[model samples]
Target chain A: MIKQISKPPLAIDDSAVDATLVKRVQGGDVRALGDLYARYSVMVQKAVVRTMPRISDADREDLVHDVFLSLLKLVNKFDRARVFRPWLYGVAIKKTQNFRRKRSVRALLLRQRATNSEDNPVHPPADGQLENAEIMEKGLSSLPAGQKDVLILHAVEGFKGEEIAEILEIEINTVWSRLHRARKTMLQLLENEREEPGGHENGV
Target chain B: MVCKYLYKYLDGRLDWEDRRLFEDHLAHCPACLQQTSDWQQILTVAASLDNKDVGARVAPPSSLDVQRFETMARKRIEHLGRLSFLGRPLAVAIAAAVLLGIAIGVWKNEAPDTPHVAAPAAVSSRVAPHKSDTSGAPSQSLSEAPLVSPSATDVHFDTKVKELTGSETLHASAHNGQCAHMGPDTLCLFPKSRAEVMVSDKAHVVALQSGSAVFYVQPNETREFRVTTPLGTVVVVGTRFSVTVTPEHMLQVVVKKGTVRVEGDNEAAMVQKGAVARIVSEKSGIVTRLATWDELAAFSVLSKMIEEVPAKPLHLKSAKKPVVHDAHQLQDTAQAQSLKMLDTWRKEMIAGDVDGAIEGLLRYLQAHPNDVDARFLLATCHKRKGHPKEALALYQQLAQHQTLSVANRAAYLAGDVCIKQLSNPQCALQYFTPFLDHSGRDAPQRGEALYYKAEALLQLGQKKEATQILESVVHTFGRTGIGQRARNRLREIQP
Candidate 1:
């Protein structure tokens, strides 16, 4: 597990230190690279965790490493005239999204094979008691990626619809609509489950 | 319309005017309120499902990881260095020509005034001088080679301490723009410039702060000589090479004799004779190309060798380890006067003062509201005091920062509190799923994370996935404590 320390967010006004460090790193200073790592490793890790919430620790570490490597490689491409945070955030989000996309494909293929295999059943007896979480997972798994992302980001991550809209590159109304649909779908699934022969509401 | 309002109202996505209208409508409608209540119940349960698959967030890679990366980066940089040379196909062919002696043969046949057609002439010129035997076969041609002048003086340096490994070796001084005769067979020549360098005799290493230095290592010697720059390290067994740290702190290694290894970050490269390797940054762009003769001209002048000054024997012993004390007790008073840091809370908790620890953390949080670690500690103390709801809320808040080192643990704890302490297994499912998802195969808590996820699945009547995860835990982690519990649970569920 990565050891994380809490520090205040980097002041938006403090681009000077970042500039000097960037210059040093561009100049091929390995120690300066280490300094940059110390400064932003946490921020990058947080971005990975928040964006790809289900990613493992080791994978997260590798992602963080890749982020720094990308930063170093593309440091020249970065517009030093602008703020570093937004650019870094964009890179982090893109990398995480790519990771999720690739993983999703792999998982989908695995799930498809399982469904195709007659020997491998889809699930055990439906008579097994349904926990609220299990029912929700099933509901969530059934939702589309866009809806699932919005639901998790808004409901679980506590991001505002507007904030999520910008983060996910969708409209604010889209975020709202997705959140609403996600919730509606979850409720519908739960309601349907309750109507079943042996099903109970599993009230909170 | 009722579903729309209830869903939007629960999500807090309703417009202000709509919200007011909904409130007015709900005030008179008991049925609407009940519907809202049921939806809220589902929403609350759905919320827990988000964190169910997450594992505790760890801190960034440790210092050890950083060091390992550095070593790996060094090797990669060296490899990239050679790869850069390969990028220029012309340079590669020219290097091949030099090795086959075709370049030297062509050069020997050409008139002295003939314009050098290739960069190999200048590169080959440097190595030719050092290979001369006692009769000076190669040095005989030094006059004909425009780059080499036999008038330069031999530099000298005092031999410093030597160490085998796992220790530091000290050098006497650096010769700014001057060459030094390192030993009987080793000759180190520095370009006319300003730099600080430390040469270690036993380890055969040179630490350069700035400027460039060329080394002529006799081929017969079996020992390796290494040059350490601010950017990377260059290691050579026996070679004629020059290392320069440019103004941009870029490390460039030019090989004139045998191959030299250049390492930066996680990468390494080997620079063949007449080839130059440069690391522009820690990034992937490593340049290795054939060096033009003009670029090799800087190393031609050998400085006046300064007389050797014997270094006084300075014995260095390892420093004794410091005594350990309670970090909170000693650090809190020293670092902060008013604030009770996490150490203090830890000390209180370890002393079995759960109330005191909770109070201290609360007081600390009062001043440092952004302190998630303190919040996490407070939640742990709350759990110890058997206040599951309070702890769950705090854990949720801490878990919001997915990157937090304790976030995964907080998520797991939240699930545990909800399922075991609060009897909300549905909520536990949310936290447990995320915990299982993010938990690495090597994580000590993986068994528990898997078990909890299974338990949540079983509770939700999802027996297949639950059974699979439970069986996995039992089989994979059979020797562990949680694995035993998983086996027992599996039997209970299947029977």
Candidate 2:
């Protein structure tokens, strides 16, 4: 007979662990909240950082803080029997959306101000600096705001298109349409870049 | 039932019967298989990019922090309570004063029987001649309150128009201090007003606040009407046009029509009626010239067709293929057989036999280990069976293969298993990184891989590094799904 290695104590069954933590938290055991946070923060932080690329480290930390604060406010509303990870993730996703909307508004205002200043024409980034990544970012940012939101939720956040629709309060078909258009636009832009002499490093 | 099942299947939230049916569909439908491949790729990319640190780092706000917040909240609440006690009488007094002012204003309007109130009522009544013509039954509720006083009602209507129509559309009509939603499709059809109309599949009606009203029509179907705008889009069944109001607010007409005319903005250019012209800057005036085919394609309606059936195999029966080489024939034969096998599996899955589908795929894979499609399907089947370890192993094997395309698919699957099932972002990064190196044109998988790689990095507590990768994804494939995700992620990370 083969001997099996003993499972570690911390290797509690996921379902059981979540149920216990939820029960404790609901019972006003503050430490349970900390435990849950410790368990899920790494994933949430990773998700937030990956979603908000242009945001600085300091800003990322602040957003992470905001997510936690929001989560606390929502702990009481959680369904104890259900897994907390998805619910927590949903909160993180919402916070990220709010941050992006605010950033977009700020960027628009800044652009308007700069345009009015007349000090210098807003020149496009120099050719050399337009890396594949930068080109991709510009193309994405140029998309309609709604399209950008749906595409990001479905593609980056790892949410199903249906999940995205639910979160964004739109139809799933809309998400699909936005994603399709976004891809087509990106392809067109990339192809255009490739056509220019010495424009893109990876020529077609 | 079909939509529900598809949703559940895609979400991996399906039970046994549904899962079996989904697998059968996968086995039989080549088109569905291709779509499945695409969806798998997307999921893989997303998993690779997901923050690994999410579960590990998420801690509820500390007791001390919560206490501090609660204390502050308590103090604020107490302060508000006290303020309310003193504010009641003062608020009542202020309310009485406002009511008196309103009463005076109403008395003034009553004395003159002001033509202002009558003007709106009469104009609305005229615009909607057939009150009983509920032909297009207004889906949205229209407030019945009179718009006589400069009261909240008028303000509310103005705000509603601004919200429903865009700022650009309302600018002209709002300036004339008049804004209204006309017929069902016509939100604000102000005649003789200079309006900027944005016409596309997405429609909007803008009412300009300027003396000259601008009308923007994003017309869906063919409808002819004269619209006055400093800049407007005159759309035909198969054409697009633009009219703009310059900084000087002068109307500039740019015709992007399949067949239309440029009458006002400047010199009348009797375009073939299907050409594009631009009202140049305020200094230059209207430049109504013919547009190129590329420009025409831009305004061409973008319609997507969703097929219920899978994509059929391309029949290779061309005149040039009369005598094919043995090797080429063998390859074609193999492709045909693979397609048939896929179809069989889909039928089985649809019949609600997930295991049978998997068994068939497994047997097929044994003979064709190099078959990326088969391998991917098999891995997915295993995943559906709740066997993440086996699925992960197969995905890993495929990810390490020589072909970049095949490897990318495998890498994506591996990443999906790691992040979604195994909950291991560290493991997912290992799979995602190789795909990112060569994620280029034929491999949209690369954009996806880079996205996942960023997620894995973040999970590992490499915040700065992850942010850099995400930024790169946004910059390189910004318009693509992966790029959008990166941009969204960047926003979430902001302070």
Q: Could you list the iRMS of every candidate?
A: 19.8, 25.6
Model 1 C-alpha lDDT per residue in residues B77-180, reported as the tens digit of each score: 45556334223212111010111000000011111222211222112211111111211332234224321222333434435422223222222233423434
The weakest ten consecutive residues by lDDT in model 2 chain B span B96-105
Q: Which stretches of candidate 1 lie over 4 Å from their true place?
A: A1-24, A35-64, A80-143, A151-167, A171-204, B1-60, B74-495
Once fitted onto the true fold, the runs of candidate 2 whose alpha carbons sit more than 4 angstroms away are: A1-19, A50-54, A79-83, A93-145, A155-157, A160-166, A169-204, B1-16, B42-495
- TM value for model 2: 0.29
Q: Candidate 1: TM-score?
A: 0.29
Error of 1 at B350 (Å): 23
Residue range B408-435, candidate 2, lDDT tens digits: 6677768867866887888987777655
lDDT of each: 0.52, 0.45
Lowest summed lDDT across 10 adjacent residues in model 1 chain B is found at B96-105
Quote the TM-score that chain A achieves in each candidate: 0.51, 0.51
For residue A143, give model 1's deviation from the true position in Å: 4.3
